[model samples]
Target: MFFTLSYRKTFIGSFDKIGDAIDKLKQHQESYSAISSPRFRKSRSGEIIRIDYGSSDCYYLIEKGERDDRTIN
Candidate 1:
């Protein structure tokens, strides 16, 4: 059996899976040795995941209830 694979460049689709992020994590820095601005999400989902920006290695929010609840989601 033989198989050939080719790749095409395109826009990144929606981030719906953890496995979809296979690209190498790149880091950005400023001349003043300062961290970049942090991103604010509306939900607790992906809250624990630290972004490549700022120096907040251990900063996040903790939701009080389940994420699947009607009011939460």
Candidate 2:
């Protein structure tokens, strides 16, 4: 028999430059998008999780998963 698990992770912190943070993730080829609303919306089955840009240089990142039920969206 085999079993599977859903994985999720979030990164929250402040950065001196947002571009710097973006550049770092880009290097890893991690796909991401900006959160347009206060809440994350669900779309297709394979929706790419989004990140939020807070006041100043603060930000939040949500990792995507194959089938993440942990999030509302």
Residue 29 shift from truth in candidate 1, angstroms: 9.7
Question: What local lDDT score does residue 12 receive in model 1, on the 0 to 100 scale?
Answer: 24
Model 1, TM vs. native: 0.18
Model 2 worst lDDT window (10 residues) = 1-10
Question: What digit string (tens of lDDT, one per residue) describes model 1 on residues 1-73?
Answer: 1111112111122234433322222211233224455443322344434323343441323222223323221
- Residue pairs with colliding backbones in model 1 are none
The parts of candidate 2 lying over 4 Å away from their true place are 1-7, 10-14, 30-73
Q: What tens-digit string does per-residue lDDT give for candidate 2 at 1-73? A: 1111113333332234546644554433333434233332222234233333333322334333333446423
Number of residue pairs clashing in candidate 1, backbone atoms closer than 3 angstroms, sequence gap of 3 or more or interchain = 0
Global lDDT of each candidate:
0.27, 0.34
Highest lDDT: which candidate? 2
